[model samples]
Target chain A: MTSHPDVEALAFFAEELLEPDEERTVAHHIETCALCAATLDELTAVSGVLADVPPVPPMPQDVADLLDRRIDEAVRERAGSDDTATETGGPVAPVVPFTRPKKRGFNGMNLPRLMMLAAAGAVVVGGGGAVLNAVMSTQQESAVGGSAAPLLQEEQAEEAVPDAAQPYKPEIVGSGTDYTSKDLADQAADVLDATVPESGYGAEEEAQDGSILIEECAVSLGERLGVRFTLVDDARFEGAPAWVLFAPMGDTTEVYVVDPAGCESPDGVLEQETFTTR
Target chain B: MDAVQELPDRELLTRHTQGDDQAFAVLVRRHRDRLWAVAVRMMGDREEASDALQDAFLSAFRSADRFRGESQVTTWLHRIVVNACHDRLRRRKARPSTPTEDDTLDVLSNDRLGRVGGGPDHASQTEARLDVHAALETLPLDQRMALTLVDMLGYRVEEAAQILDVATGTVKSRCARGRAKLLPSLAHLRNPHPPRDVTTGRGGANPS
Candidate 1:
């Protein structure tokens, strides 16, 4: 009480934060000490100063759009397996039974596969020569037993539309330094291993954890190529930054290394490889 | 659809758990603005705030069934949002950032350049907001969050305690320390009278 209390003590006293005895002592001192009293008043006004400033402008439009898209994707993924009996009246996509083509070879083509072949044939006939060129590339790659085919077939059957039954989205797993063809094969095996145990394929993951630019690239690229990539590795290829995209086929995985800058363009694909799951 | 809009938060959450798909979206639409305010204040950057809010809502949606109705749904949402921001800030701090010029300066200049004739009042208001955010960046995260909830956002101490999952006294003490630390910078901003040349010696205690 004899000397003026410090400013922090005054701040504590204002919030009633001091010990009872100390609170009493400060209270008695500030009663007569004009300087300490003025400091206390200034400290008390801090909140008013802060509150008087206008708040940050309402959420930006792009952020709102991103939020809505993320929420919609979540709703669809959950609705696929949502067991509750209540009829959903919202504008959600009708829940489809989760299906993945098991190790059914070309000889075992079923109804969905036949439908898929019809769809691919239709694409070749109606969609123009560019799509046919893309499909023919897949056909040639499929000719290599170690390369792509069943994925193009499955992508036609499953995600014929960009929004259909996307239980898995591209998620970044790790940096892609020193990734050999062997490493790509090993990663493909891991992706297939992760898919077998659950229909959701780690659907609970924070799938959009990558930067917005990377996510948009993956999505746009998926739309262009007509396949949803399940795993994306931020990669370095030929001493340049690249992205490695993985989509699990029947028993093999299709891997593409693309330049992140021009990800939506066909020229962006720096390399393509496929390896059968062991 | 009109009826869906009229349902209360708890009813919406209950319906969401029971498989009504629209209920959660309606709940989000009703509360996103207020939650956005809390998040923007917690994280000074808009993009980071957006990311945090999305993470929180998705988490809330998934865990709606486990919410035993112990607290108001709004409080629960706020807790998730604050925790999300906390985790991001911790991870951001763990990795040292590359050196760059102050982003707040860029923001202040951009505001001035973008607005043509917003009037002096409008311009100064933006400056004040940026200044406050810059000052807030100096406090420890725990104290920053406490003061943000109690002082800037005007939540009650008890409410802040609930959101922060800390004791009432703990919230009060954190706010006290934060206020003390902020006083020197804020006083310079608020008081038009030029600061005296004489350093009160106590002024040296200012963390910034």
Candidate 2:
């Protein structure tokens, strides 16, 4: 009845997802309308192009091995639970891999990725780690080092994995270690806009001032969010309260608004505490 | 692991459910290629996809009892993987950035992409492939999954509906909308009487 069958109809026509009568109707419409016919062609082209994408290479063997170990552990635990159930007739609970993983502001980093980061930290500069270090180093200094330590650590690791001999907790996002540039950086999808707390740190004396500890902490956090702290340019922007540090990763710049109050509180800046980076 | 490598995915999954962890490894090996393809395409980042794949396999291992056997084992695995990818996508707040043509957009996937600049032939092909991927990233998850299953991965609409646990009409609409979006996003790839109609596998592909 109608001259146009719409995109769904064209898609159905391309995939033969239509009824025989519907198919004929769409085909007949295509024959009469150049736009419908052309639309069908474009949809067909998209399908063709998508189909051409090469399959991703197989997962790295080491990661596969790690997964195998975890699964094996789960199966073994389940077997143990089954044994316990048979002996005591108690209901067996499923083995949760993580304990309380859903914490606020904690990036749900996979265990293998954490392992990779640990491995990268211990030896070779992993591509991911380098990227992570460059970006996360500064952010960690600021995000967690401030009065937010209790909030950050509130979501502490329950069962810390013994990563490479060190009893490392995967949940501890801001590893204080100075990370080199990037093999293992977390890809930050959207960096939150700066919501700098109003304070009395805008005085000229506070400009170009911040501690090395503050810079390191910021780097630690920023690496997790893909922002590498390159250098600290003084708080030059108009009406800026704290010393501003610009952390440039690839093309985007993460403006770290340093609280002169040494990351104390919303009330004030802590002396001449500015921020710098590696 | 090598002995069970040839076993069908269903058999391997069943054995894994029966507490034979090694059987799962065989299944993993068998489907790694296709699994990687689905995850990489869905998640757009190899690292993110890798994490999602691990999570999916683990979830499958843990919840093997829930699979009702209404669909193919591959489809079930894909469904779980797609859901996990969606979780990561939701967690990763940024809209995925489209990579430049020459950018090694998939460096972490392996060494093959490292050698991608194999003259104009490979260069253009890789660029076109990346373009489609970027376009796919822009679509809504439901629409993207529908197109991915029905069009990209060569599943029928009914089969995709089964995999996604949605009505067939939903899958059709989603695929259609997805295709609609891709048409303009990939306008550069389209041409009059395009010479390449034969993709080896998947929808509307000319039989070779």
Candidate 3:
């Protein structure tokens, strides 16, 4: 089969078509076809330059301020009309409420209306008596079946008690020499286990022991293909405050923490950080 | 509610429908800058753009009930601005075309990329920028609007189509054609050498 020039196919690829298989096919074609390859390269270069264009400057302050006042006046006028309608106990000028009851002298009662009234009357009488009868029967049944019911209930209560609690005993496990900070770090790590990089947390640095101190630490997701979760506050966990930041790399997320020493260093504190995709 | 506090666009629309003046103000405050940008880019004249922006917003407020929220608030407002710009363009075309000296100078000086005799000023770069502006102005109104929305303003093709009331396919075709035509105008900035010919399966060859 003969294939056409496929300008659209080339354009799609040049635009980052965002599909892996299509991208791979386009890559193959560019490698084999010199003309397509050159065109693709030129288009990509121009697009990169275009992406650097700055945003349009904001509107003038005076114009914006004037519009702001006008809008306020319009909204207030509307609110005032609504208030007047409420006070007068009548419909607003153009917007008449649809709830005004219709005049009744027109025709004989319709079948649908008669049927609805009859159904309501029947429900009032039949429903009230049946409910009373059901309540009486249930009470009588419970009274006559008392002993058997109590035994069943007792068995159910026994079964509800967890087997694990039967021989419960308090056990103290030692996380030898690990302090509150270490415990918090471990907790933070566990919370972000799927996101943090394996090489990110230094293994040699042990967490210090003290009362959990709420320190402002930045928490971020590691490099992965997922949502970027930026934690705004240095959250206090069990007492230690840790900064959390999140970034998506490819298929996984990575989380990182700024060490306390680095946090105190007078670089005026780096408020923003960058993440690399793996 | 405190009338001065900022309300979201949807809330403002609701209040406007109920005849709330302050709510309308909040809506205008929220959208004025973005709407002004759209109008200015479309009309290429700041004064005309400002008028279009105000007129569009006023019309939108006047017909608040007609806005059914089928699309985004910004998208709906954009439709109004686009229509207003079209109306302005039609009116301008009907009148005599007079190129004032200041208009010519403004067109010339805009080539500096807003940097007047400050940093690295290259003649070719300046000429290329002016050529691009002129070429963009040369395109049909629809194609130009599509290009500005998709390429310059960073709107998604689907969103642009919605705002322009055209099919997505139409938007894609217009954008592709518009960008291709405008490419030659920036030839000074692009590579000077042309690409080699490549064979097509249809028993023909074309240059890249």
Candidate 4:
């Protein structure tokens, strides 16, 4: 009761959020302490100020028009599915088009995006022909075919990845192999699509787990770039040893090529490009 | 359709679930204005708000049968809208496209200009809104949503709790934390003439 509580405590006091004993203590202290009392008043004034600010103007016509259109789409899609189900008299074909690109050979790969793929926990690749059970929640949710479903599906899709397994072993396509900037997009997608079988590389794989250094570097770059890269190519770009990072953003994937030694540094990203994904 | 306009919210939801197509649109028209206000405050951007609102309403439309009747239809709608905004905000956080700290301050300064120019009341009001929203952007999503519902939209704490699906105490504590965070940035905004030396003035009194 002798010392003035900090502002957070005073704020909690204003909200009656403090425990009874602490509340009594602060209440008694603020009763005599002018500064604490004034601080508490300011906190209350903050809410009052927020309350007094005017409400948003009416919903714009454009937004209303968009909403109506989206709803109409949803209704029609629903009606179509229902009609198809009644006519077929069996399981209805899924209306959601899982827009995955064709299964290209996931050969030749690298490292930065591997960290993110492991991070997203979605693609649990066991081996070649490994049924890469990507949780694919976004596409599946869109399977429900609600018109607004796709707008916020990525968040849920990102969360669907499991955190436990070390099953992801990225194929490091020939370190120091030179890649032309022209073919980098195709090369990046190849790495992104590469998956190794779950078997082999027992203790050696555990040792590679020490690539926590590379993982941390990728994480730092991801934070700086505001992208969780799903694949990284530890290959050479033009001539120098480089790390190519791939991050998917809806219909497009961004590729960042960085110096291996300086990928963690601010000037690490030597080249960056965007390509439309199929 | 005219009669559907008079239906209560729950009645419309019931009818929609029972395959009355017009009922849902009527329900949307009835509450879209208030829901828009919530979304705009939560999002701090009109386009994102519009997207979130559309996402929420369509999700509601598709899932009407899942309505358990434990809460009011409006409460249910608010929950969906808040959740939709939350998801988009989380993803946007991962993208570097959000305005940076310098941009927010630039917005605040320009808002001050609009006020000092002695423009029409409508313009000043709009600037005040911009100032408020800019300050709000700095807060964590949970705190921002709580403050938006309880303080900005003036929902009751218990009502906000229902919409947020949290305890009433949780809402109050979140509002309290948000207010504490907002105080330093916003106190000067309340004063007509902001002190030039912010470091030495009341604006500098950061309690945290």
Per-residue lDDT of model 3, residues A1-278, tens digit only: 14323655665565554269877877876787877776666554344333333466898875575455434433433444334523532221121111211211113433223222222211110111112222223323423453223233323322331111100111101111112334533433333332211111111112222101111222111111111232212333234443443322222333333333354332323232222223
Candidate lDDT values, in order = 0.61, 0.50, 0.45, 0.63
lDDT of 2 by residue, B163-195 (tens): 677889889878877886666655435554432
Top candidate by lDDT = 4
Write model 4 residue lDDT over A1-278, tens digit each, in one string.
55879878888998898999999999999889977787787787778778888777888887787677656655554554444533433221121111211222224433334334343322222111221223223434543544356535533322332221122223222223366688887766665554332211111223233244444555456544334444455667988777776655555567788887887664787887766554
TM-score of chain A by itself in each prediction: 0.36, 0.30, 0.27, 0.41
After TM-score superposition, the amount by which residue A105's alpha carbon in candidate 2 deviates from its true location, in angstroms, is 22
Q: Write one digit per residue (lDDT tens) for candidate 1, span A162-234.
A: 2222222344433435355556556545533332221112223233334345556765555333344555666
Off by over 4 Å in 2: A1-9, A12-29, A76-278, B1-11, B93-120, B192-208
Ranking by lDDT: 4, 1, 2, 3
- Fnat for every candidate: 0.50, 0.40, 0.16, 0.56
lDDT per residue as tens, model 3, B1-208: 4654566677778876765656666667777788888887777666667656655775576556767888887788888888778655544443425353246446555644465543435654554444444556656667778877887788898999998888887787676655555444432245555333311221111011
For candidate 2, write residues A1-278 as lDDT tens digits: 46688776787687677889999988888888887887788787887777766656776675566556545555554564444433432222121112322211134334333222322222111112222332343235324353223222312210121111110001112112222123112111111111111111111122112333444334432322223343332232224334433444223334444454444332222122112222
- In terms of lDDT, the poorest run of 10 residues in model 4 chain A is A92-101
After best superposition, candidate 4 residue A136: deviation in angstroms?
Answer: 12
Off by over 4 Å in 4: A85-249, A252-278, B99-106, B112-127, B191-208
Candidate 3 chain B: worst 10 consecutive residues by lDDT?
B199-208
